[model samples]
Target: MHDRDQDIIVCRCEDLTLADIRALIQKGYRTLDEIRRISRCGMGPCQGRTCRALVQRELQASGINIKDQVPGVFRPPTKPVTLGSIAEGAGRRSDHA
Candidate 1:
């Protein structure tokens, strides 16, 4: 992660750079909530499964308080499903795997 290549991509959906996030952290934007609100980090399709932890650690290294930082909520299904994927007649899929 040396130097983050100076131009490394961070939030791939929004095309935000590590440099941009770091600059935000260097200012007073000290929480994941704050970062997301202002910089739009984890509001993308991958849903922070990739970038959330990176953003969290980066902010923490900058002295942010993450213990109470309030990561986003997880709603039902918790996995993606298309409406067509739902079956009219169904027993749930087996867990045999």
Candidate 2:
């Protein structure tokens, strides 16, 4: 592959390049979840919102059939949560007990 392609930033949140992902795939980290756990590619602020598709594309280019490959689960609170809300919820729960 060309240097430009390798240097392509797939996950900007983690500053990961395509080469980084390719290396992970070659090491048998084929699934998105596996790569995420090891390289922390999509575990960023976007939570794969931006990088999931890119990761899938990379996997496909590497000859992996991603049609059945389930992407990693993305939990809620996609944005930052304030500590005050957490404390308030905890207090309410304690009152019911």
All candidates' lDDT scores? 0.74, 0.87
Displacement of residue 54 (Cα, Å) in model 1 is 0.4
- Give the Å error, residue 44, model 1: 1.0
- lDDT string for model 2 (1-97, tens) is 5688667899998999888888899899999999999988888887888788988988998999999898677788868578899899999999999
Candidate 2 global TM-score: 0.80
lDDT of 1 by residue, 44-65 (tens): 7666667788888887787767
User: In angstroms, what RMSD does candidate 1 have relative to the true structure?
Assistant: 5.6
Tell me the RMSD of model 2 versus the true structure: 2.5
Estimated TM-score per prediction?
Answer: 0.67, 0.80
Name the top TM-score candidate.
Answer: 2
Candidate 1, poorest ten consecutive residues by summed lDDT: 88-97
Instruction: List residue ranges in candidate 2 displaced over 4 A.
Output: 88-97
**Cα lDDT, model 2, residue 78:** 68
Which candidate comes out best when scored by lDDT? 2
